[model samples]
Target: MFRLVVFVASLAVATTTAAHFPWLYVADDSEPRLFFGEGLDHREYHLPDAVAGAEVWQEAIDAPALRLEMEPLEEEGFLGLAASQQIEPRGFLRTTIDYGNYHGSRLIYDAQHFPAENPEAWPEPVLAPEGLSATLRVEGDQLVVVILHSGAKPLTGAKVTLSNAEGGPGLSAATDDNGSTRFSRAAMIDGLNGLMVMHVDKRATGEISGKGYASTTRILTATFNYRSREAAKVSALQPLPQAVASFGAAVSEGQLYVYGGHIGQAHDHSRENLSGYFGRISLDGGGWESLPAGPPLQGLPLVAHEGQLYRVGGLDARNASGEEEDLHSVDQFARFDPGTGRWTDLQPLPGPRSSHNAAVLNGILYVVGGWALAGDSDGEWQAGAIAYDLCSTDAAWITLPEPPFKRRALAVSHVDGQLAVLCGMTEEAQLSKQVFFYNPASRSWSEGPDFPGSAFGGFGLSAWNLDGKLYAGGMEGVLYRLAEDRSEWEKVDEFQTKRFFHQLVPDGRGGLFAVAGASPTAGHTGSIERLDLVFAAPTARR
Candidate 1:
């Protein structure tokens, strides 16, 4: 008699029989036939002599009886079912069979049909598939692969392998009890890093937050499979002309331009904050050179827009009107012409702000959260956002909605078509890991993924987009990579030291320019470094 037993949580029993692990298969035709025990589940479902019983049921919208009857089989290693009527287009089949010596060895299966048109139209799974899954992520020049089971349980002692996407030899890792294991990205192949979990344990299951991935209903399979086709690694590049920190830097005409800031030994703050120097570094290996100087400014927002380098507000403690003329902040605005070597003043900002971040798109510039000086109270960060369109003749600062939260010293860059704001200091003076993406077309702000490792930003906030990938590093001394297609940031490589206040510009030659910055012990380093691209290739193919 057909029966449905109550599911007791504590009595949950899993099966990963080394002898027979059943799998269901279907043809690639419009009207396909079903089969069992063929591909990876080779030894799982061997047909037994005098078969006990096999039954099939399909999810349906309109059916008299969803249960199915078996057709007489001439095939040796296949299971066939004859349904009475049409099945739902988005439907799947659930099967149970007894064909082994093990008592009560009933296997349940939920297999989805391919060629699904819409995700919303897909039917829910009748039974969950028990398998392995993993993700290969960039972690400090290493590719760490996190492994999990079908129920989001981490599998310890599981054997995993990585190979070229097309097919080749591979690398192996035995998972730890925490279900955590790592691989090196520098050893990964150029194409896709194809990963497969080789664990065969049935008693492994764990609780996981459902937010990370959608239900594996449509993509259900007996074995877990994943691919991180594109990965990144950071390496040392060229050093800077001199040790500079807390300065204004920008990239124009494939060159990096800098403004005044503190020039100290390493990451030391003892350096004088009074320099009116300006310089630029060429991509042709010409190195750094002095440019016409402007008003000594530091902690100012700079950007390259419409062939002109523009400067936003700044903090002016180094002014020479005696010490009394020093101001905590100023609402100054100007644009520099590299040709004439002069800056033309423009309308000042809506307010006095510094240590902020900005991005330019289509001749319009957007400046986000930053700290503002108060006459009496300590400077507090502001949530205000403003924009200006230089393309318009009567362009004026326009106020927009507040950003994700109040913060300052952030790395903001334009990626793919969105403005991504990352790193910063929170109100509590903690490293901020919140990521926000602003869509210009929709005029909307959405939350992105938090950085993989630690929070970063502050006076050290510096980042840029190059080679179709967003590269961010500083303060935290860890270089992060985020491609347009990825929602989360990956820890690609680590800097030589705990550096901050550095400038990052794409070299356009498959590398990046690491300008001067400050390190904890090094004080200030004029040592500019270049990070060439690195990748992991397959050691052997299996």
Candidate 2:
């Protein structure tokens, strides 16, 4: 009985000691938690005491007695603590560490335990301006400078000084409200020989701290050539030669061959009122020549098909008694062969019409939407559209599909194997900006985007396919390029001047030549202008 009592006393002491110990859990490199030795006192803890049993509950009671709540000894292998010391708490962590030696490994910490704070100050360096640019014009020896400040606010009250390579006396000026400065006698500076350099002083202050202030200097080159406004005005005042209207103009091999559009008094006394003449001008050479007068017609010649120019359906005779009769009751069609420089009669059109639009598609000439005379009165507008095949000279003119809208004086050009009709006058003689595209293959019409500005009236409309894109020029002196996807139209550039009744001929290079346009301001300019399309360069971003 005494021996049993001693054993029970020994087991009770052992249980009391185990109840005072606290459990320890260590995490492996993979963050898997593992059991370690329990401890009533931290110094008595041992790693090998780790086991899977109910001792975990006994250690929980001893946690406060061992002071296990103290921060782990982050050094040595104590409870799997790392050997490195705990990092000092910095204001904020930065990501600018050099990863070249470390092979891209990042230093990470438990963000929850170490919450970041607002930085007392930013350690990053401040950036400076890249470069300075200026545009200047010289009048005689004096220079006028125009500086562009692209900053958020205007740089007012800045000082600008000029110097040359030799560093001699240069002009100085204070910037005005608009950030512009001009020197009265910049030419008086002796050292400012060929190249002049201007210096700008910009003063900036810190907004937040009031402790930092910065002053930057920028240099600009002022080498420029200038002309006086008086000289430009004098050149503009020079008179231009007058242009006389003569007809038989043919566009041959991309050149305009012009013939007579003139009528003169008859030489015989009896036939004093009857006179007709014709002349031609080559757009390449800019000279006029005469063509034999065909039966008199009071109409303009139309050129269709690649090689043939036609004069079809015109009033034949004029009477001396102040009355005129349409003698050419039947349609008359004359074809001029540019290869041989001769005229031949072809099969006439089915109906007599005037002021019509003609377009050639797939080797067929389509005459569209014109006016026909009702009685002896003036001609009435007609909505009929006709087509003729040039391959069969004797083939009668056949009625093809008509336009969705009846319009006269409209300009039509072939675009992407389709005919695009531009702005023209309606039967009421009012201009319209309605644009339409007709597909000859599908025999369908689709509406296109309207013009940006007002409809161009009596203006030459032409389209050319360049680099797989279509460009059209109108009377407003604006050239528009069609988006390749046919979604929208963009205004590309403006012509040198506004003109009406002009002709646009593509140069076959990616440009266009404007010819024979009547300028309302200049009065029938015979001058030709060429437009070369330019594109903007792509910009680089930092």
Candidate 3:
């Protein structure tokens, strides 16, 4: 019994000692550093000579790895590293150390430094470093850490802990089958945050450098400095060339393109109020450049795929200002090439449609939820959707299975490889909050979470999948981000101006642009609002 008690006490010591793992620190325009610590406690005396002496290297996308110079910064409580070459965004600093046997087991530490100050600047296909390591990334409003073993194999069920520099009880979660855990950025204390995970292989009993061990513990840590205390701000950009609503807008190759829309009073369609103006502007900032005008249209959406803009059927006003409104939906599907500076006609939509939105997935353009407005007649609601293969030699409209309900002025976007049709107007002319999901692979439809907003705010809702996350906005001015599980949308931030019939496009800088739409108070709004994901730096815990 005494021997067993002693063994249990040794195991407890091993676990307690393992809590102090190696961490790497990276900051903007600053030299990266290494430290041995636990949570918010930086242990200067615990810095191991093996950790300090380990060779360090920095790696980046499309760049060769370069060795870094190490300097002992005992006064600062960390070991500083200097890179001979500049480490680009998404690049990381890594070091490995064999801690040798301690408390009846062997401990190995692998540390990585990732840039987290500006998530927008981080490049993709974040290559995970060799050995047991974790990669940090931002999805919507959550910070995700994916732990891996043997470079690519996911380490499942590993307990991961996150601690902010402010300290307190940090968040802890277990890795899923995908080796990933998401921490709510809203709940996490801003500033420098450290994530650590460990894997214990009792079967890994072996000798390291003649130091025998009862087991092996691999501890991995990824550290990043971020600020998220500032509330997301909404600022106006250069306004559109004209105040318009029900227009079509898309972003292609870093440029914003807008097409025809109604320029008159809401719901009043006349040839005089129809806008045939087409223009483009660099998202980086510049005055809008006028392009050759196309047919005057309204209630349509523009989608971008492979650096080109596409438009399907739209409602066109035929009557002059004085005559009775003569409205008709046209089946003129076309593509606009920025290089050629002209629109090319493609196979028209299956039938005339208007007030519809579209999304592109896997090179296929899907048009959803609209209606046919014939002259002096009630609009015919379209219950089905259509798809066009952009990559095919002979691209044409392919009718999809009909959805259960008919909606107009709806928003369509692809998320998680499925198409999500958001709120709009139903056949009864009632604003709807219902949402539906369609799986192209299964060619079936599934009901999704209803829009949380009131029915009045559902009309002219806009949704887009940006950076693999779905975001939506409506007349309510509330911006919502879909939960990672597709369960529901949690409130993100709100727009300073509540508007509808606008487009939400990526600002090409890890932000979003709420383009021209009709405002409740501002009438036809031509203003452009930008939303950026910036973490407000919180005050240090008093």
TM-scores for candidates 1 onward, in order: 0.52, 0.46, 0.56
- Candidate 2 per-residue C-alpha lDDT over 306-349 given as tens digits, one digit per residue, 9 for 90 to 100: 76677655444434424444333227777877667678887787
Q: Which ten residues in a row have the lowest lDDT in candidate 1?
A: 1-10
Model 3: what TM-score? Answer: 0.56
**How far is 483's C-alpha from truth in model 1 (Å)?**
4.7
lDDT of candidate 3 over 90-112, digit per residue (tens): 44677888888877678777777
* lDDT score, candidate 1: 0.55
Give the C-alpha lDDT of model 3: 0.74
Error of 1 at 27 (Å): 67
Q: Model 3, which residues run further than 4 Å from truth? A: 1-236, 536-542
Whole-model lDDT values for every prediction: 0.55, 0.42, 0.74
Task: Return the candidate ranking by lDDT, descending.
Answer: 3, 1, 2
The alpha-carbon lDDT assigned to residue 171 of candidate 1 equals 64
The list of candidate 1 runs beyond 4 A from truth reads 1-241, 265-271, 318-327, 374-377, 456-459, 534-542
